[model samples]
Target: MNRDEVIAATRQWIEKAVIGLNLCPFAKSVYVKNQVRIVVSEAKHVDAFLEDLDRELEFLAAADPQDVDTTLLVHPTLFPDFLDFNEIAGIAEEAVVEHELEGILQVASFHPRFQFEDTAEDDIANFTNRSPFPTLHLLREDSIERAVAAYPEAESIYERNIETMTKLGLDGWKALGIPGMGGEKK
Candidate 1:
């Protein structure tokens, strides 16, 4: 997919699955307010991707909360394997510390094949972090703290999301038409 198509698919996934399924209670507010910035990276190499991530991390750190609460840096074709993407995700976290924004910013990851440790590849719970493409979510620490404070029992969100996806099932997920989930292979 082209950059525009990739972005559109990501937004659709955010809307139809993230918000529609209430996978993330904190997502809807920023998303509806247009504070969520989705950037599709064309970086083909790991070095280029890290550069993109650095730029985005700086951008998000400097951006105002009302203007940009979070950023999703997506790469359509890089890191097809979950393990490689997972390693890159670790590097992203290191980048946060390298930039000296460790306390102010955090990196979250999502991929089409996002599988948690010890979980089956197709476990419904993994869908919680699954996205159309490989994505690095840059979020403000202050925003997260505030959101967590306002949200009662924020710890339950994960379990709730798992339950939600379990009920949705693969067929239900497929029915949502999320990009990259068109087959039964994943």
Candidate 2:
């Protein structure tokens, strides 16, 4: 898919799986407020993607939270393997610090093959973090803190998501029409 197509798919997944399923209690608030920025990266290589990430970090740091509270950098073709994506994800965190955004921002990763440790590859819990494409969700620390404080039992989100996905199961996920999550696991 092209950049726009990829971004559209990412948005669909967010609307359907994340918000529709209520995986994140805080997402709907910012999302409906138009505070979410989705940027589709045209970077074909890892280094190129990092460069794009640098610019995005600068943009998020400079923009007012009311205008853009968070960003989702949707990268379509760079890291197909979960291990490779996980490795580059570290560098993404480092970039935030390099941009002097430490403690101000953080990166949450989502991928087509997102897998939880100690779980089978096809485990339903993995779907909780799965997205149509490899994405870096840049969020403001203060906003997260506020949301967490207001939310009851925020620590139970993970377990709650697992429960949600387990209820949906793989067949249900496929029914959501998210790309890269079709047919049986290879």
Candidate 3:
């Protein structure tokens, strides 16, 4: 199915089944491609939450396998304070391989306030303005190698993204800070 169709179907499932179950209080939710990411503030009860989500997904799969895939990324709020984009990308790659998923579904969770120390508000704004998180990237594995080989533009985009993140660092810091300004006084 096309990306838009996949997203629309996933949204319907969330509204109908997920919301009704009260599985978790969604702090933020995004659907792209065929993936759905739901972030909740209170993640202490992730097991119970995933249990319910799994059940709903089962129903969805039975009814419409095209809409819901077996692979899911469950990111509990207590994950870590220092996870970076490459780390997350690696996790996604691992998930795809481990689950034998046709596509990926990623859920990322972390403390909302963590950004204050980890990233500049301006940097965050700039990053989000350029590329928003919880974005849906449609990848057809069967054709990915061929597509990449054929598409120079795709390779360019990938390289640029890596370069940008490297320049910014995972924490977006040239150096640690004093009280107000970034970077400690030497």
Candidate 4:
């Protein structure tokens, strides 16, 4: 897919799964406010990808939260293997520290095949983190703090997400029409 198509698919997943399912209670607010920034990376190699990541991290750190509260750095074809994408997540964390945005910004990972530790590859719970492509979500620490403070029982989000995904099931996820989640081998 081209860059625009990648972004469109990502937006659809955010709207249908993340917001529509209420998977992330904190997502809807910034999303509806148009504070979510989505960037599609065309980097063809790991080094270039990290460069893209570094640029995004800096941009997000300097951007006004009112204008861009969070960013989704989506890469469609770079890390097709989930394990490689998972490793990139560790590198992404290091990038946050290298940029000296440790306390200011953080990175959360999402992939088409995001398997939680010890969870089977096809476990429904993994669907909670699954997205149309491998994405590194950049978030502001202060925003997370405020959201947590205002949210009651904020700790239950993971369990709630698991429950939501389980209820939705693989069939339900496919019905959402997200690319790469059709329950067929790619």
Candidate 5:
């Protein structure tokens, strides 16, 4: 897909899956305010992708949160496989620490086939992290702190999501109409 198509699809997924499902609870505000920046990476290799990631991190660091509160580096071609992306996820996190932006910036990952440890690959719960593409969600920790503080019982979000997914089941998730998310081959 071209950049525009990639961005369109990503936005649709955000609207339908993330906001529609109320996964993060904080996503809609920044997204609606246009503080969310989406960049489609054309990197074909892991090394190149890392470079792209570094550049994005720097960009986010240099940017004003009011102008760019968060960013999504969408990589549709690189690391198409979940494991490959998952394996490299560590490096991504390390970049944050390496930059000494540990408490300032954080990375939230999503992939077409996102699976968790010990869970069955087809587990419906994996949908929590699944997105239309292997994308990196770079967020400002201060924003997250504010959101969590304002949210009562924020700690229960995860458990609530698991319960929700369990109640929704795989079939229900598939029915949501968000393309490229839900069910198996995790």
Candidate 6:
């Protein structure tokens, strides 16, 4: 798909995932890196964003499932180059950070191709330590609570992942290929 199409599709997928998991609007924005940085915003509109993501992932997966594994490390934060990592970090609460990190790690671990170490500390540290690269930011209001209320299962999964990551150590996290500051991929 073209860049515009890819952006649109990514938004859709994000919407579906949120609706499917019943997540709340805790924050907005996602970052990813391609040949260059691309930022996809307007994520406050959960439905629209998720729809776009769903389509994009489906297209990529259909083209080649291996692409998913290869590109997962591309860094979603590299999209929109306008935002700052510290700014995004400021907007996020400990709970939200824990939740997202856990969910992503779980997904990565379960994927057939990626070999995510079963070390939560390692994963969390690697993710949190990532360099600030502005990409897509979802503008959320009070949607996160709604999502949690609607999708209890997804919430549980997120919680489990957070707990697991918390147990891992900084050294372990460094072992993972998580990015450092300034979008430096390790």
Name the top TM-score candidate.
4
Write model 4 residue lDDT over 1-186, tens digit each, in one string. Answer: 999899889999999999999989999999999999999999989999999999999999999999999999999999989999999999999999999999999999999888899999899998899899999999999999999999999999999999998888888989999777675654
Off by over 4 Å in 1: none
Note the residue pairs that clash in candidate 5.
Answer: none
lDDT by residue for model 1 (63-136), tens: 88899999999999988898999999999999999999989999999989888999998888898999989999
List where candidate 5 sits over 4 angstroms from the true fold: 182-186
Weakest lDDT window of 10 consecutive positions for candidate 6: 105-114
In candidate 3, stretches whose alpha carbon ends up further than 4 angstroms from where it belongs are 1-42, 45-76, 83-95, 101-152, 161-186
Q: After superposing candidate 6, which stretches have Cα over 4 Å from the reference?
A: 1-84, 88-133, 153-157, 162-186
Error of 4 at 113 (Å): 0.8
Clashing residue pair totals per candidate (backbone < 3 A): 0, 0, 0, 0, 0, 53
Ranking by lDDT: 4, 1, 2, 5, 3, 6
**Model 2 bad stretches (over 4 Å):** 183-186
Return the top candidate by lDDT: 4
**What is residue 141's positional error in candidate 3, in angstroms?**
2.1
Per-residue lDDT tens digits of candidate 2, residues 1-31?
A: 8877887788788889899999999999999
Relative to the unseen true structure, what is the Cα RMSD of model 1?
A: 1.1
lDDT of 6: 0.32
Ranking by TM-score: 4, 1, 2, 5, 3, 6
* Global lDDT of each candidate: 0.91, 0.89, 0.34, 0.93, 0.87, 0.32
The Cα error of candidate 6 at residue 162, in Å, is 4.2
Q: Each model's TM-score?
A: 0.97, 0.96, 0.30, 0.98, 0.94, 0.27
